[model samples]
Target chain A: MRSEEYLQKYHGVTKFLRILAQISFWLVVVLGAASLALGVATLFMSSDSFTFNFLDNIRLSMDGVLQFDLSLANITATTKKEIITTILFALSSFAIIYGLIISQLTSFLKTVENGMPFASANVKRLNMIGILFIVGSFIINTVYGLVANKIIHALGISTLSVNLQSDANMLFMGIIIIILAGIFRYGSYLQDEYDATI
Target chain B: MAIILRLDRMLADRKMQQNDLAEKVGISVVNLSNIKTGKVKAIRFSTLDAICRELKCQPGDILEYQAE
Candidate 1:
């Protein structure tokens, strides 16, 4: 395709995707907020009838007794409640971080749609996203894994095994994005110089 | 801006208006004005060649270097 054709096609796609990303970001925010509020409410409820458990990777259910799928056997009621609370907070934090990534993506796409792919703002946004992904994965995924493993070991639950592996792919992807951001900064410089030239 | 464009002095010496020089050089008056005012960071060799041909001078005559 011709350069103009490619640019036109890219712009059309960027505009459409930006709108989609905006909608998706808002949806994630609303869902994350509602889930967090519900979880917190159940955790704080003083009634004996309200029982909750975080089972598996995604252990949220709207059941009456809030019982988790994980048959956390040979643990006291207090310990079980504590574990549930930890999962609740961790998952909520994870959701918010995930939503943040999406929000950043929406903003990035908006800039692309504005026909300024080599803008300095894009470089900063990509750098921020790279940090968020790497740091968020470390804090929410790897850190949580370590804490969960310790809790499991201390509790002596051999049957239960939380995912102890960190996402190496995500870490590598973050590094790649950071590298891309640097390259983008160079591209922005060239673009500015080109525009300034007569 | 160590290399200064002496286009104004050249025009004055020739007793020619900027518009006449711009017309002879096949360039806009605004572009010639930019070159005159040192607003442009750099000038194209082709533009400088055209200006020199029209003004009957060498490149050195239109450009001068002064230490900062």
Candidate 2:
């Protein structure tokens, strides 16, 4: 309340939202990746192996949630179906993770725009974002390794072996962010004490 | 916590309403109430000056130090 006048006059919430919107616009890349994956799956995969049970499970879940009828069963190709299925699975997993990250960021930014960056809600958001990033990167890495191995086998490329490795950079960054969230929570507690004191 | 506000007592002795004193002191009623209820961590000198001037009392008459 003491700095309300300065905050209201200089801190434009709309401006921040605009910038966030611009950045979030790049999320279109996820859609592009999904489309590209779908195309590649159609080109390389045989019809039988392309609709693996796991892939069908994913499709069925997605269909139930999104109410969309994806007709992947119509393809008559007989080669590289497993590879295609793996690629599509990886892409879909990445898209979901990216969506979660974006949603968390949007909510966190809104709280910041409200001029309470150290609020408990923002702290929780930060923690959630951090955990999501960590878990997401791990999942992506595992999926990528699986897809790579599947593709190698499909292509009869026996010389290469896929190794499972976590994204170290994302893991480290997530840990730092989680620590920052904890610090922010402490700051929020202090802010609450200060606000209540007066 | 050791510092207690005697604002309610002072207001009674001066026969002044909280609303009237808040207006005279140029602060919101909520702020004045916070001060009266000893909820404020600190008071600005300007606000204290205005309150003392309006209430026709010294600072000592409004604030008292008590051991916790």
Candidate 3:
């Protein structure tokens, strides 16, 4: 593509990513503050119980012999600690993943804006995002699983269990991004060589 | 360390300014400056030919080799 078209494309993408990055930053700050507030609130209201309605339906069919439908028809009650922990876990996980991805994108777009998309800094940022996706997903899922189990036990719900599942798709995507970062690094080297050839 | 650019000396001997030579050679002043300062890694044959044509000098007059 011509340099003008290339720059225009990057300019538009950078503008969009800047907005996204700002939003993600605010969301992370708000979520962090909310988690802290919830912790403090829990300390004062330790004995209170909160009820949450299921947002989706759970369907079970066993060999056409029995079928059961569970939905908002189900409401679960839990203590203040359980509610706070669950909310904090979910919010923190979202904030962490969203913040990492957006921050990397912002930095990458800035490099492109400077007319150097194959910069060494962009490679590092891409690799950082890749590592965050892989490790963050694992940590978030594990924390959520542990928190859910603890909450279920605290609620005296003996029939329910929390199972931890690793996200293979996220891990695969992270690896691909890491590989792309390597390719970008190589591209940066080639660009340098080309520029040096006068 | 071996190849050296004598563009500045040649331009001085020809009594021509860098900008005039750059204009005649049809290259940016920045690129011509880089060539004169020996900051560039390699020179294109077309660029060398243009510079030689503009200065009315052989490539040997613009470039010299000295062992370091």
**Top DockQ prediction, candidate number:** 3
DockQ of 3: 0.67
> Highest lDDT among the candidates is held by which one?
3
DockQ each: 0.31, 0.43, 0.67
lDDT of 3 at A151: 51
Which is better, 1 or 3, measured by lDDT? 3
- Give a tens-digit lDDT track for model 1, residues A1-198: 964576678998888888888887788777777767866876875534324433323433322355434445445555555665566666677778778888888888887777767888888889988988787757766647754664566478689677655567778888999999999999999877755443
Off by over 4 Å in 1: A1-5, A47-87, A143-157, B6-39, B44-63
Give Cα distance to truth, residue A87, candidate 1, Å. 4.5
lDDT of 3 at B49: 93
Query: lDDT tens string, model 2, A1-198?
Result: 566675575458645774675476466456647756785757654465444443332232221343423343333335446556566667767777776777777777766667766777879888998998899768988977786566556456667677787889889988998999999999898877766543
For model 1, what is the alpha-carbon lDDT of residue A152?
A: 69
TM-score of chain A of 2: 0.67
The local distance difference test score of each candidate is 0.74, 0.73, 0.75
Candidate 1 residue pairs in clash (backbone atoms < 3 Å): none
